[model samples]
Target: MSLGDERESSGGYGGTGQTRTRLPDTDPDSYGTQRRGPRSSSRGLVTVVGVVVLLIAAIAFANRGDGDPADDPTTNKPEAAATAPTGKQPVDAKAAGIPTGYAHDRQGAQSAATNYGIALGSADMYDLEKRHAIVNTVYAPDVATAQLPDFDQAYSGESFLEKLGLDKNGAAPSGQTFVSRVIPVGTKVTSYSDSDATVALWYTSLFGLSGESSRNPVTESWYTTTYRLKWVGGDWKVVDFTQKEGPVPVGRDQRASTAEDMTKAVEEYGGFTYAR
Candidate 1:
């Protein structure tokens, strides 16, 4: 059965109220020590060091009186807002080419959900081996094992592949590039614990084929996916998730990129390792 058929038959894992859509045809050096010199040279160096120290001390005192710019309401510096960077670093490891090794906190759960959502929506999901690897890496062990066969059946349908202008193997036709990308606009932690957390990722996705001969030109969709994550083996892994179509915004009046340009853009640009 195809993904749509599976969704219709059983609602699928984490299907919730999500509407299933048809597939479009589619990352610093040190210095060495020096030898001591003459007394005058040593004294000069000491004087210079002392002067520098004093200058630093003076600057510190001046800044101390002013307090932190962030703390000072009168300061012109922008306040830390919800949209501001959280200073949290992204995961530094990869499992089956998907980012892993997330921190063990709410932010980590959110990050894991966001990245996993991207992986789930990626073009790689269309390929059996790649999809399996992604599922094993992103989902909890039991979930991965249980869902593997379902995923394979859902994504491997010959009709589904053909609808997207792909072969049974999910490869695009020659000279055509399939596009499937999810860009997380934001994430929120709705629930949290040491062992479990629930995160919602709001995102926009581009999917379809970017080629001159394609009938389903690349198009964008907005979605929000809620992921229930578990801390497993020192990393956040998906336990369950649900997707819902947009909280979509009004479409903007802009010229769409040509197929060649879209293909080039997808090829030239790289996806991000998202963080909170």
Candidate 2:
């Protein structure tokens, strides 16, 4: 039998009618002594109908205001169109291991910026050859050629590598795993044209080493990066970019994960090519 049936069969309040009670009427004159007059009952019915009519009128008035709640400046409700998805399919091609073939529009520009942010912040960017490939794939030809040396210098410094617990070759120490990943939270197009666009990407990143003996355990940081993109060779390519510290939210009260779990997660879970 089901648990409910078993309970019913156990002779408790579920099956028995003994728990019911009939309270005494509030009107002493109508409690097993006298009946209410027809006039009094009719009056109560009229009162109830009047109250219902008032409630309906109030509701109608509330609904007939100047505009929708979303349009009202004082309301906290956001416009539906702001958050609605555009329903555009994600790009299905990659060039130099980065997503490519974005549409020539605002949404496409945002998509390009988002994916470029992820590529630039990834651990692969630490490797010189992979870094060069990313620079060429994501930047306009002239910009890439101009900035390649600067990028190389910035990422190749031994001091920078040592700070992140990596060796001169940007490889983690033996038995340790290095992690650098950018997860785009949102994207916005600040300005757009047929050939050029400016977009901003707000993102969080996981960086540092994950291992038992590592001094720099992987941690999260938030930032916003703005990209100036130009349509070059039929794709959105970065011409220039800048980054700043986050519009960070307050951290939650949660215990940190063990280094082993972090390392395992980084190894097991693959990242995504973000699009808007």
Write down the TM-score for model 1.
Answer: 0.74
Q: State the local distance difference test value for candidate 1.
A: 0.73
For model 2, what is the error of residue 11's alpha carbon versus the real structure, in angstroms, after optimal superposition?
A: 83
Error of 2 at 114 (Å): 0.5
**Candidate 2 per-residue C-alpha lDDT over 51-156 given as tens digits, one digit per residue, 9 for 90 to 100:** 4444443422334476677765546746456565764568999988899999888888998999888888888888999989999999888878877876676567
The regions of model 1 sitting more than 4 angstroms off are 1-6, 14-85
* TM-score for each candidate, following the candidate numbering: 0.74, 0.69
Q: Compute the lDDT of residue 165 as modeled in candidate 1.
A: 70
Report the C-alpha lDDT of model 1 over 140-251, residue by residue, as the tens digit. 9998898788788777778767766789999999998988898889998999999999998898888777777776577776778788898999999888877677777755
Give me the displacement of residue 183 in model 1, in angstroms.
0.7
**What local distance difference test score does each model get?**
0.73, 0.70
